[model samples]
Target: MTPLAGIKVLDLTRVLAGPYCTALLADLGADVIKLEPPRGDDYRHIGPFQQGESALFTLNNRGKKSISLNLKSPEGLALAQEIAAGCDVVVENFRPGVAEKIGLGADVLRKAKPGLIYCSVSGFGQTGPFRDLPAYDLVVQAMSGLMAATGEAGGAPLKTGESVADLVGGLFGSWAIMAALVQKARTGQGATLDVAMYDALYSMLTTSHALHFYADKTPERVGNRHPLSTPFGCFETADGQVVIAVLTPAQFARLSTLIGQPGLPDETRFATDEARTENEPELRSLIEDWSKGLNTEAAMVALAEAQLPSAPIWGIAQASDSAHARARGLVQMLPHGVLGQAPVVPQPVQFDGVKLMTYSPAPGLGADAAEILQAFCSVDAARFEDLKKAGVVA
Candidate 1:
């Protein structure tokens, strides 16, 4: 509902992590100005294009004004500092020290505006030994043990289907910025946030933490199943796979009845979660015998009728195009000249049964430069023309 209506965010970052955080702020009604080089963000040229507009870029940059500025120029740097002086927050995802080298470091900006919230997104944190090492989603996921804990037990480690590390970093970045804003509101003091992809992704592996921290063991790659629970994985049906999520004894009992073995849970080997996990193979065999005879829908229906939790695995397209997604307003269309309408996928938090916010289409490169410059920097038409002519701005 435009909670951050008057807040200003200067998005100096590009690619996924920085864009994602700024996108969230923009969706929540912050006036986000995405500053890019004259050539624009690399994502703007990346593939999966629709009518020559990069879908990847359009999806994350919605509702933000774009300003193409040449930060390498001395005048451009001064303008960036000036624009940032008027903003509430500035977020960057450059390598740890690059912002300082480029003359827009936290100290410089905080001195210019004491209450400014500066966020830096990186592969590793600013103080860590690995902070100097370059990293990507794949690197973080693999190093943080998320990839190691994924996939089938005997198979090689695997990365998630999506860029989870990057997304997780962005998520924490947004959370930290909001938290800093809250603190600033109370104390009139700014914060310098250091959000790392490695830390964020590693923190998200709760199950991995459970095994490594409590049990002194590495979490095994358990594939689609809940690692410690039996009968909590995908079961094959005649048509496709159905997910079974029987966790508690009550759910397990219902599952037992659904599989035509009501007393199975009472058996010594299957009486407790630990016992059932120790004998998972036998339990899986029994569950499949019942499920394999039915189609996925049939199995799902039968499980539902028995009050057991079950679901069917759907591809991305199938899930996104489902009735539930449409009904919940999970996908909203934003008008775009190139694509006619580009889908804006926002967080799925419902406020009083309504979507949190709606965004306009992502701006074209430097599309809002003049408006943003006039509004924030008080740059007149002549000065704006001079800057553009000097290649200081585009």
Candidate 2:
């Protein structure tokens, strides 16, 4: 049987983070029922459309069912509560107090279903000073000190190219949900997870945090270079940039040999890791002087022959289309009704030699409303239609 095959999730999240968490669960064989409002998830309106539908929504929300409900109505709330009672997990990413205001708070849901795992993915948390502050990926990236430590020297601090804060929050939420599920199985108890994007992103800045805590050193924007390790960053080659990471003394020796500077590793200024780090500017210059004579691919090949670590910096399309990525089943094309086929980056995990893959596309807005209500709520067809007419269920 697939992992989490029998587990059910009530997904009440709209945008990236919370939806991504539930999407991971769905890929793991959970029955994730995405509960949207009458108008559907806000992500569906985002740009980069695929055959008139949102590509962002489809990519993040696959292998799940969608149900639309008018939660502001009393009847709608009753139906939601009823559905929650039957679900194993309920996830939301509303602002701090919005869930409570809508009467769909963790406390309310867990009270009705004692074994339910209630997960709240928020900007800050439920009870912090900044809990109510508006937050997006950029806000968290800035507040978490990620941006402050991410750019080229002397340049303004830059946010990462992707929504790393949101992605990190989702990753942590998925882990927390699984851990809570395991605990529930052991103790017959549920859990309330307060996964804040700010906290999650902060926790991921391990090197920066370590430097600050151990040495009272704030990390600067060193671009692609390692803060402590010399010769462990990208360097320019004739064709393009290539990353050369020489962390060990042996690797440094090999790097010197590859760059045709055989005596450089023995020099006092570049002998040890610390000494080399201090003289990194000179080291980079000497290495790049040789590397600039070779194309990125040739430099990479030469480094590989010397048994040193190096790779050409790849753009998104290049990385996605790489043979290694295809061999690992990292790239997949899933069928979508609107686009016929949609490219999906699946969960990067394998269990017992089996990669987890889910092909179902993101559902249409309220597409499975009647079927879901029939199965979960046990509402007959006539009553299901009436709920639609009453504007309670869409």
lDDT of candidate 2 over 1-394, digit per residue (tens): 3688899999999999999999999889999999999989999999898678998999899989998999989989988888888999999999988998999998899898888999999989888799999989999999998999999988999999999888889999999999998999999999999999999999989989888999799999888999889999999988889998888999998888877899988899999998998899999999999989999888888888999878887789989889999898987898888888888887899989888867688999989888888887899999988998999987
Candidate 1's residue-wise lDDT over 61-154, tens digit each?
8888999989899989988899999999999999999999999999999998989999999999888789998888899988998888899989
Error of 2 at 193 (Å): 0.5
As a TM-score, model 1 comes out at 0.98
Stretches of candidate 1 off by over 4 Å are none
Compared with the true structure, the alpha-carbon lDDT of candidate 2 equals: 0.90
List the candidates' TM-scores in order. Answer: 0.98, 0.98
Candidate 1 has which clashing residue pairs, if any? none
